[model samples]
Target chain A: MTDAYSSSRLVAGVRTGQQRSIARMISRIELGAPGVDLELAELYGSAGRAHVVGVTGAPGSGKSSLVSALAASLRRDGKLVGILAVDPSSPFSGGALLGDRIRMSDHSGDGGVYIRSMATRGALGGLARATTDAITVLDAAGMELVLVETVGVGQAEVDIVRTAHTTLVVSIPGTGDEIQTIKAGVLEIADIHVVNKADRDGANRIIRDLTGMLRLGPPTPPGEWRAPVLGTVATEGRGIDALAAALHEHYAFLAAGDGLEQRERAMASARVSAIAQNLVAERLTDSGLGDRAAQILDEVYHRTLDPFSAATALVRVTT
Target chain B: MTDAYSSSRLVAGVRTGQQRSIARMISRIELGAPGVDLELAELYGSAGRAHVVGVTGAPGSGKSSLVSALAASLRRDGKLVGILAVDPSSPFSGGALLGDRIRMSDHSGDGGVYIRSMATRGALGGLARATTDAITVLDAAGMELVLVETVGVGQAEVDIVRTAHTTLVVSIPGTGDEIQTIKAGVLEIADIHVVNKADRDGANRIIRDLTGMLRLGPPTPPGEWRAPVLGTVATEGRGIDALAAALHEHYAFLAAGDGLEQRERAMASARVSAIAQNLVAERLTDSGLGDRAAQILDEVYHRTLDPFSAATALVRVTT
Candidate 1:
């Protein structure tokens, strides 16, 4: 496969909803292959049609099962669904395990449902960019609904979840003070909160606690949508319909006012800024200023030059 | 207390190990005050003398108790200790809770121990910069040992932990499958791993799991230090002495060859790059190019401009 030939064919196949092409494009983006930029430019027009939904929670929150159930529900509504599971886990365990595959097996042979798992490779910021690009690819491939799942570990993961049009934060019962950690950063980003494993003990208390926390915050504006907490036993397919309905409700809310447009604008600004920063860093390295930067870093490390001054100098030289 | 006078006085007092001055300086850094660059430049020389240690773990892992225990043990050896706890939790809580303060009350009014907690107040990346600056301030204040503690949530938190000379990753027993989450990213960064709450069941299993995982990788070089997995019951101060000894041994290992220098150089490079990126972002915003950037973002959002091209253009203009 020649580079030019494959690139053009991949773009065409992706536009027509070919699974192999979509996977290939995502792989290229993940690997940071040459000329992927041009391919992305060609496909950019086809994106912005799919609704990107981000699902996030701690490990063992049963988010995988919840996501699979949600996807099945969306498929029942005749929507073409694409799922991107962002695994920040180590490379030793490549992709999803057998259990995850079995959980998502219902959609395996369905042409309308596509699933891909992405591992955290390279820098953390790069992972975010890759995930965003993957979402774009899915969106461009004519999927009406796209699901992005990630574990909430730190700020970076939370930021990734924030990029979605609607974010579902999943949690389980009996987590104890673990909810406190979620309240700190993750809760604020959620458009819909899910208490998965609702059959487990303390589920109602978890919901009540979340509601109380929500109440303690400043009141929502009259027209703005408030995040609704839902319960689900994902394995039993309980509450999946209500969860899907809530997702649609939030999406409608975003589309009603300038909310959706505003979010898109903010996301675009962030994306551009991230890309520009990476480019600046790469430019500095590629332009032979890396050695100079290293020298200044040494000076800063040895206390001969202050970091602020060293940074200023490096920026001047690189720019 | 004019600006110039206070800045100079703050530097002088910090150099002399004054607690009030250190607090004020950290406050200025966290708030992104105008004159902090000058203050930092003056204090840079006094740094590079303290051995910086970072403690990180998931919330509810007893990291606070572990840190406190380690600090007390270090103090027993006649070393002054400074502690900076980076709380990614929200601002409504306002620093450490009374419970946390009570936990460390044994060191209260002790001049040799200084503890300050930092909350995430402003931008995400800003927290990392402020944390690094706070470390510098503490180092300049004649502290022989400094502990930088943070909750492991996402990549940003992990990056902050990596800045330390020795990073201790704390975990509790029976965290089943949660350790799998840890293996993805955090395990690779640990200089020493502590399974706190050693009296609990499954502590040995967790240790065996970690050791087995470590053995699956290639053999460590002869001179390089292998990350040690230790068990601790931090609340009871069990294994505190051994933990402290391991820390000292790691410090010696770092100081033996060019290991310490190499780490310092890498940290310095990262610091400079971060500051430079921030400066570029600030400069772009301050010079009226922010509006232009936003306009480009708007175009990208509307799909009139591709993000890649927009980013390239923005980089060209800013650089």
Candidate 2:
């Protein structure tokens, strides 16, 4: 197939939400393949429709299960949903690991639900860049909602999760690190707090802790959204309805105010800045300045030039 | 109080290992304060002497205590040691949070020991840059050994920890997420695996698990160093000697071959690249391109242009 003809076909397939086309495009994006940017730019014109919701928490927080349940609930509401399971920690686990695929079995054979997994592509902003790109593909693919799920509250994960219009932070009882999580600044970004596995011991304590913290948290201004703490038994499908309702209410709240537009603008600014930085970094590391970078880095290694000065020199030459 | 005069005094104090000057310089570096670069450049000349060791693990793994124990052991060896405890998660926890200060009470008034804590500065690469800079300050301050401690095995933590010449990955008994840590690529970077709180049940199990996993891990050629899993009750200082021995042995092994030079070169490349990226990000966000970035970002928000294209435009203008 000619390059032009193949690209056009892939674009058409993505427009019609063909799974194969979506997967292929995402693979190319994840690999940082050439010509993908042109295709992504085409898809970007069709995006801005999907309500992106991010789910993140510590490992063993049942994030995957809660996401599955949430997908099932959203599917019940007759909404087209796309699930992006991102594992920034694991390079070995690629798109749709076995566990994630098994979870997708719950919605197997359903046209409304599309599930995919993404792992680390490169160091430093690579995963986030690819994630935003993949979300665009899914958004353009006509999914009404895109759920981005990640398993840790690290800085990288937080940055990824913040791309969502509404973010759900999943927690569970008996983790014994609840206070640390709150202290880690995860509370600030959580549009809704979920205490999963509510049947387990200390579930009420977790709920109570979250409630008390939120109450004591900075007072919500009048007519502004206050994050709610909800309990869930994701495995058994209990409380999934309430969670889904909260998700909708949050989205509605954002829509009712300038919150959605503000979020869009902020996300745009961040994404653009990240892409620009990545472009510059790639130029310095892999392109025209590759040799220069190696020489400058050697100077830094030998202590002949400080890293900051070396970087300044590298940037000067590149710019 | 002139800038030049004060800068020289600070440099001199750092060279002589003055605690106040070291603390002030690190604070300035952490805040990305102006003119800290010149001073850091001077100090960078004196670095590459300290045997930097990094200790990292999941929260509640007794990382802090183990670090404290290791510091004590190193100090007892008549070596000047600097401890930098980094918490990337908490924005509220600034330098020297209460718990960490108390942990340092163990070495209170010990002129040979200096400890500092660092928190998030800004999003994306901020902590890592600040960290590398602070390590320079510590390394140049006549410390024979510098231990960089961070909680969690997230990408951010992993990045910071990898800057060390010898990296110690801490684990504990019964975290129930041990396998996940290995799966997250922590095992690959670990030169020595220390299971803290070894008095707890399942310590043997974790040690066994780590050993078996290591054996099954990629083949280790003859004379290549294999990561050792050791047990330690950090609070009681039990097995501290063994841990210290492992650390020293690893250092000797690195010093014996091209490993030290290779690691240094790799770290230098990473640091310089990160610094260059941060510099570009700052310029785009704060300097000449600030207005242009805003305008381009607005276009992205309106979906008139894709983020990738907007980024390309921004970089084009900046360059």
Candidate 3:
């Protein structure tokens, strides 16, 4: 697998939508194995054709179920789909239960669908980088649509929104009102608002509240896209078609003018900066700079050198 | 105020515990104004004396009330305290409700306590940096104790825990379950577990669950500390003394045998790395390198260059 011949074969296999090759490529990327970059470079040209959709909501909001149903709907349209479930690796949340995989098991034999879960294994910005790379692989693998699902927690949600072309913010009724959802910072990143489990009590009230809040919130420019609140009962696959239509509508909106181009540029810029930072950090750690850092830290601890001066010196020496 | 004389005077005033100077200094730091770094340098020597404590919990968990009660108890022991309330600035949360401030109004005129709220204003890593600088200011202001309270959500909570010497994870009965708390990522970072609103049903159950999880989860090295769960009813002020005692005991444990020294060095290393990264990012953005990045991104977008190669080139050019 480390030889040039094997690498080229892997890339060729991935470009032809071979499941085994695609899985192998993704696994190598996730493990940060050597020589994967060459493979990515070979397959990178085949990407940029898939529409990436991000689905995020608080825990227990049925995000996985909703994403499963959404994938099924996309498949029904004779489209190839890829699903990436981002887990935060929370021990108590049962994020490791493989619930999303189980729910989508029906698509296992379809050959038109692919599913994978990515976890944040204590790497700074590593998950985001792996996710972006995985999306590229899936896109190159001939998937027309890719759904990225994540729990609405911390910086992960923000990163997902930045990476995806369209983002859906999911919520449920009786989840501590509109205020709690807003405080989670997911509302601001939402391109489309979804009230899942719409059959439950207070569903109408939540929709009304969300609508009113959006109205009073930041003013949308004329001719700009306005996020619409939609209701869904994902368990029974209700509203899946409407949701799919809304996604397409959003995509059309992006393609209308310079929106898609500008968005792609912005995303690229973000990715570049993130990778630059990670690379610098990695270089510093891989070299003997840790000892120098410790020495400076000791000086700072002993009040012999201030943190600002120490940091400036460290940056100067390392960069 | 940007001149050296005024900067020295400001530093002196803060060192002498002047409220006006402390407020002004913190405001300047939060704004990231010029000359604040010099002020920080001048005051950095006096900052290591204060015992910094972090209090974090989910929304509607009575975290503010618990912090208020804890502050009163600390003041009763003849210690000057500074309180920093971190608001995530969710427009719907009504962060300006003065809810936490109102609860601590009893100490408003005490002159021994100072409370201020910090809000995230769309800055990358800005909130954490500002919060850390604010703690330095408060520490130099002769505060014997400083309480940093933030909502336990996302990366912000992780940042708070990393910056503080002792961290208290707050929870409430009937809010959810032990798994939910663990999912928040605060469980692993906690130095102390606080179940506020303990009079509610299921408080004991939560304690039992936490205890069981800790027992089965990880093995603590001999002489190292293990987190202990404590119950409290903040409104009634029950268990306040015990909580305070636990905090002191934790402080003693850290102070014994180079523990505090090791922690301080680790913190300094973390801060230096963060500052170095921020400086590199700022330099790249200010150097007209964004256009170069966009050019590379355009190549990547058109499949002329792969993201890995483009990112490597960008990092090379920028750094």
Per-model TM-score (chain A alone):
0.91, 0.93, 0.90
Residue A70, candidate 1: how far off, in angstroms?
Answer: 1.5
Question: Higher DockQ: candidate 1 or 3?
Answer: 1
What TM-score against the true fold does each predicted structure earn? Answer: 0.89, 0.90, 0.88
Against the reference, the lDDT scores of all candidates come to: 0.79, 0.84, 0.78
For candidate 3, write residues B1-319 as lDDT tens digits. Answer: 9998998999999999999999899889877889999899889888889999998877677888888899999999999999998764332232443486595576878889988877654444566777888899999899988999886545555675578889888888886745566775668888999988899999999888777877887798889989999999999999888999899888899999677887787677666656665665564442545566656767866778876776577553111
Against the true chain A, what TM-score does chain A of candidate 1 give? 0.91
State how far residue B179 of model 1 sits from its true place (Å): 3.6
Better of 1 and 2 by DockQ: 2
Model 2, B1-319: lDDT tens per residue? 2389998999999999999999999888877777888898899989889999998887778888888888899888998999988887665445455478778788998999999989886758889888888899988999988999986677788889989999998888887657667777787789999888888899999999899989997789988998888999999999998988898899999989989998988888778778878876776553445555667777888999998888777663112
Predictions ranked by TM-score, top down?
Answer: 2, 1, 3
Candidate 1 ranges beyond 4 A from true positions? A88-99, A171-174, A198-216, A281-291, A316-319, B58-60, B89-94, B97-99, B171-178, B198-215, B280-291, B316-319
Tens digits of per-residue lDDT for model 1, B203-236: 8988887878778889898998999999999889
lDDT of 1 by residue, A1-319 (tens): 3388888999999999999999899988878889998898888867998888999887778888888999999989999999988765443333554356775577878999898887666653677788888888999999998999885545666767878899888878896534554545678888998999999999999889888888899999899989999999998999999999999888899999989988887777667667666665564442435566657767888899998888777663112
lDDT at residue A103 of model 3 (Cα atoms): 62
lDDT of 1 at A67: 85
Find the 10 residues in a row with the least total lDDT in model 3 chain A: A88-97
For residues A1-319, could you state the per-residue lDDT of candidate 2 as single tens digits?
2287899899889999999999899899888777888898889988999999999887788888899999999998999999999887775445455478678788899989989899886757888999999999999999999999996777888899999999998888997667667767788889999999999999999999899988886899999998999999998999999999999999999999999998988788778878877876677653445565677777888999998788777663112
